[model samples]
Target: MVSSDSQYSYTSSSDTELYSPAADIEHPSYISKILSKTKPDEGKARKSIAETHAEGIENTLTRYESSTHGIGPIESVLDEEKPEQFDVKPDTELNEWDPWHYPVDSETGFRIVQFVDNDRDDPRCWTTRARWNYTILLGLVCFDVAMMSAIITGDMKSPAAHFGVSLEVMCLCVSLMVWGFGLGPLIFAPFSEEFGRNRVYQTTLLVAVCFIIPCGAATNIGMLLAFRFLDGVAFSAPMCLIGGSLSDMWRNEERGSAMAIFSVAPFLGPVMGPIVGSLLSVKCSWRWVYYFMIIFSGCLYGVMFIFLPETHHQTILQRRAKKLRAKGDSSYRAISEIKTRSVKKIAKDTLLRPIILLSELIVFLVTLYMAVIYGLLYMFFFAYPVVYGEGKHWGDIKTSLMFIPLGAGTILGTLAAPFLNKDYVKRAKKYIDRGQIPPAELRLIPMMIGCWFVPIGLFAYAWSSYPHISWAGPAFSGFSCGFGFMMLYNPANNYIVDSYQHYAASGLAAKTFVRSMWGGAVPLFTIQMYHRLGYEWASSLMAFISLACCAIPYLFYIYGARIRERSKYAYSPVQGELKDPEQGIDSSAQDMRSNHQLSERVIDNE
Candidate 1:
């Protein structure tokens, strides 16, 4: 006899109520019908009752089988429309039978599951060790080469002079390179998302190498500038892709440390470039810089070709799905396969992000604050040489060497950043534990310290470079300014990255575009500014601007969380939730205190 106990019956009427047999509970098809008579909390009660009914049904099935045949039938459920019939077979027979004999499902599944949920903690996702290593290595190489090019191109004044180009024209070449770098992301970001990251990176790096080689052989300033712009375009691919690759490799918590290390290049490149370029320009022609870059780029290209596999999860899964489809299997699908949007729509959205971010009140203000600081810092590169050489009677080499203090300050600041970041988190957690409202504004402490030092250093550097003051005074100011620059940059960037969890790339690109534009433009007019205002008053005016920027960190420190709460783009407690504001000590603050202590100890030892 057919088992009526295991069967579930449904009526044809769509609005009819059905009851679960085990729990004797009824639920209506429409939620409105249930809510009309029941209170809101009663809906939850209905769900609990349905769950109990399911359990009772299961128990009843077990008991019926135990009381009757002592074992269940081996018959399998099959769709009646299908021709194939299930045949009982031995273990060896089943193994020998074609696994493909099973009928395919009518529905096509999605193709982008891997990309959507590639977290390590999730059982459905996993990335290989080799893939992670390759991502990081390729990222390092790509950024190193890109940054090196920016540094060398920016410092190629001697070559421009040799070519009879005015300094203004030469500086324009630098500005063009920066413009190319800024615009490159818009093109590459969407392309990487469309094509696989590895394919895009490999193709672009090769193009960059090709452009770099020709750059060394350029006969005129225009040719050199044209080649450099192309090179910038090629180099930008890696910068845009690396962040996504990092997200593929590491979890949210682990990403900060990785990003911190990756971020070191953009800062260090400028410092390292001038040091190396100064030596190269003095010993050899500026063309040798391009030649050197070509060699480095070529080596990196080979390394990436061998080591970098496609890590973009969608691409990986798509490849897997292709393999499955080739075998006549229909279960394969990618997460992105479900997306119905056209490529044009995706491109349009990607293109508008930087503009949209700039329009945001908070993002715009923060970006402006950071941009001014960055411009001022870069401007000092040009200003210091003129001040120290003409005003203090120092040689070109000696004036360039004065940047060592700035380098020292950057190193000290970078080393201290992790600890400070850790302390801020710890303190936020502490606030949470104590039942206090933890604030995102607590992150502004270092920024406050940094803002104060920025102006102080600018004023000191300006006034101390005169004939009366010793060179040590100006160098000390450089150190202080470098420290302040790091303080301002790190916190602002980290805060933004933390605030916009999914949109971090767009946020970073927005900030990077503004900062690079400022860096590119400021050097061109630095001499004019200094000449018009004289060093003392010119830097003093900059100091006043720095004073205004100090208010940014202060405002955020006070009202940051509230601002985040209202923001749709900003990461809220729901999305990779940040530490509760009140717990113990903010981890970032504690980290800063530790770093401060370490710095003091180092000074003491020195």
Candidate 2:
């Protein structure tokens, strides 16, 4: 059974004002006898009516006048009178909308209502500057939540002591927090799809803040662990949602610079956490870490509340449909409103999407690569302090300072944005000049180049750090790690968003789950691995594994077009147009516009 909101309603065939069956035809004896019945069972049949009748229904045709005559007499007529097609909106002239009857497709099992044109009110139609500002606001929220993951990583010894728990288990609190990142998106991503990104942001982030307070005041490891896990769940929102949000804002060609800036949040939080945490751990105590988070989050919440706007076009259209209904345009329905699921089906789909997406080869391979990268980064959560503090005999502050190189490298890597997107920009222009659209694989070029750098950075970092070497050598290697990370990560994330199109949030959710699962799992044995294998070999091991996956990008570069051709989730062009079934708009025109902008940019530069 499909469930619908108050604004989205199903009408009955008996409502002829919307649609009426063919008239002026001789009725068969059985139909005529059923419609000719005058002994209406009004007392028995009044309770179970199939449709609500409108005033216009009574005046339009004989079949609908039976609503007042009693359902008994009209029941057969209503069945026979069922129209072949339906009008979703009534007040507007049917001719005003193109292709009025949306036939239910076999894939979705429900017909969809779609926009006749690119509606100005749609978030997809917002100005570029306005859209980007929203992306930045989303990035800050992600940064705020992710910063807390590193809050305790810099200095866990004292927290274990204060809590009176085994240091390993107490440290597991942070690991478990990372685990929550994997699990949260399973629900949040789907919830965002059903609701909107802005709703998930406010609710989850607020709850995550509440969880932090308890961590600061926890009486035991169990309490801290529980709160941390919930916090991870809350904080995981940015990982799954932000990629989709950015994709919603910009064309694939235009997303490179925005993604460069947006991708910085995940790194910034981790980098900031260590620095700020080291200071707080030295100056005050572990509890103060949570206190500091409270202050930062409190402020972030206020800013986002004011600045963040809903960006999902379907969500905006849903509200518009609701408003149109209130104004008595009952037939006006958004395409997204067509497919309603019961709570059970919703939960089933929401939970199963990530698993199903993971099975997709592109999602699987890329997610695995990112997971390895994420795990290596999480492993650094332990590796950083050990290599710098214990290995180099540095104090808390200096150990934290060591992380700056990684952050610096990532920042410098942002320089690769224009270069990375050079292919996309050029390809887009050629297409526009020829009045055509570029293929989706154009998004993957920079990513393919970036893929090689991961192994290079790993090898550099693995070999450079030694007891005798200057800290600068390892610090500089950290820059390679950061730069290589940007080279691959920005493009991979953007590729998924561009390829998946409307389902970008769910695609990112699958990635977040894979990324966070490995991210969380790495720290569990990172110190143990270091103890067993030593630093150079361990980092080398990771690098070689990365080297093995290096083919992932190249393979995609060569075969991604074919790979996505089989993808149910991929919104590749059918013929020459990338169709938005939800919008009923052919993105061919939109693509040309974006390419036109790309051409202007190229011309200006030339």
Candidate 3:
């Protein structure tokens, strides 16, 4: 789920601010005793800033921009003793009816510099070409991140033999790496808040590339597994950051197409991983798989380092404030400097809230359903080899070709995403026309349509997997499964985000954590299960489990509203409640700041 707000988390501009007594203080002047601080005025109370904060302190910044005081340009003394010394003087001779600048809240005595309407500083105001370039680049990074997770699956046999270990031990390469995917974000997502997305991306990608070298050159299984886990940890940075990056670059209306690029990357990259790894290992050696990743990730790291700008709003404003201060004008303050979360608060939001939200039936069922889908996706990596390699005595390359249909089906599902989004919009309008927020259940419509495909695909693969049967039978069955994966995965995320509005990030983080753990574990037991049950029964077992999962979306679609109403964290808006179509939450710095931290935790757990 993408947070429409660009702010992530707050960091102090100066080290002294961290321990300063002023740091503990809330806004000095503005204090609303009974009103909702994070929410805007409701109904007829909505008005311009001048009308809302009429009792603001009598400061030079306030007097300059207040409508009652008359409009004038701000004049700053660059070489000043203090921030307060840079005074705002009126220029009645040059009053040309300029729009308000450096608007100060009457109650707070704080002047928050904001981007004006169509402000060039806003990322959403960037040229379309620039935004698309960043979008595509970030999407490719996501694909590359996902691809690395499964590329090792293609030729596990050669590595397993070389290390004098069983294939099961080699499966640790995938499992441990995936475990890193879940754990890395607990640190990096929070770090991205402090350092900003670009630095995190550049640093983590470089570390990931460096770690790949040890894996390709490892002499023992331990060394390979160790570095694979490190690389996974390093690569995990981009997986979590890209969603926030997309949100930073695109507005709600423009984000659907951009997010689609992101939506396909996780599934598509893994699908291609084995296909490419097979060709590399077959033509060269198993080590070439890691070598290929090193070269690929290194180049991507270089491109991103050079081209990606800091898109994070808090980070950008922090720099702007720093630059102004460098010239001795300390009056310009970014909201980040004024409002920040403590370590304790940050820990509670990221760590505590997600765990508590999981007890909700909506989160638990949706999470379980997603975990099953994720586990199924990982299962295919090992299951393909069993079905084709062992059952029919096929080569690595032949078994890998079978993944193409799966990739194709995932692409088809991605292509169909726009249509589904359109349908959601069309359906949501009926609720909008009646002055109500659309029920979160509307998100499950796609899931209901897509839930059947998994069982169908699995069933087809199961019954068709005989040594005598044509390869097309089990091979093409992947198409349906792949399609189902996207349809279910994407909508499930939306449902969680919609169901838990202010807490969307924690809900998503909880789901990702569970799914990643399940996905990482699946590859370990997949081969054993296949061998023990025989191909038909093993595939049939998964099929039956998936068939049971088909009930999840339907169950939620029917009763989700009631469930959400009872949920402690879920946002069940009452009918006729005014909700913004674009900015779902109230536009307040406190809310945006909280949202920033919330969004930072929405990692691509896949």
lDDT agreement with native, every candidate? 0.57, 0.62, 0.73
lDDT of candidate 3 at residue 451, scale 0 to 100: 94
- Residues 268-382 of candidate 3: C-alpha lDDT, one tens digit per residue: 9999999999999999999999899989988888889999888876677567657555654345565446545578766876788779988999989999999999999999999
How high is each candidate's TM-score? 0.71, 0.71, 0.82
For candidate 3, the lDDT comes to: 0.73
Top candidate by lDDT:
3
lDDT of 1 by residue, 361-444 (tens): 567778888889777766766777668766877654566777778767766676777787788778866765554434445657
Tens digits of per-residue lDDT for model 2, 1-606? 121332222223342332211322222222222233455474322211111111112112221111111000111122333221232222222221222222222233333333322334545557777887787777777677677887688788888888777656766877888888778766565566567778877888788878889989998888888899988878776566665566556655566677666667777678778788878988998789899998888778777777878765567657865765565445545544653446665554456665777878888898888888777767767887777777788877788887888888778777777775676768765754554556566766776676676678777777776767788866677777777777777667656655654344345557766677788878778777766888788788988998998888788778877878888876565446444435533455553343233221111000
Residue 343, candidate 3: C-alpha displacement in angstroms: 0.3
Over the full model, what C-alpha lDDT does candidate 1 score relative to the true structure?
0.57
Model 2 misplaced regions, further than 4 Å? 1-133, 244-256, 341-345, 428-442, 494-507, 559-606
Q: Residue 30, candidate 3: how far off, in angstroms?
A: 20
TM-score ranking, best first = 3, 2, 1
Clashing pairs in 3: 56-106, 56-107
Model 1, runs deviating above 4 Å: 1-139, 153-157, 392-396, 431-439, 497-505, 561-606
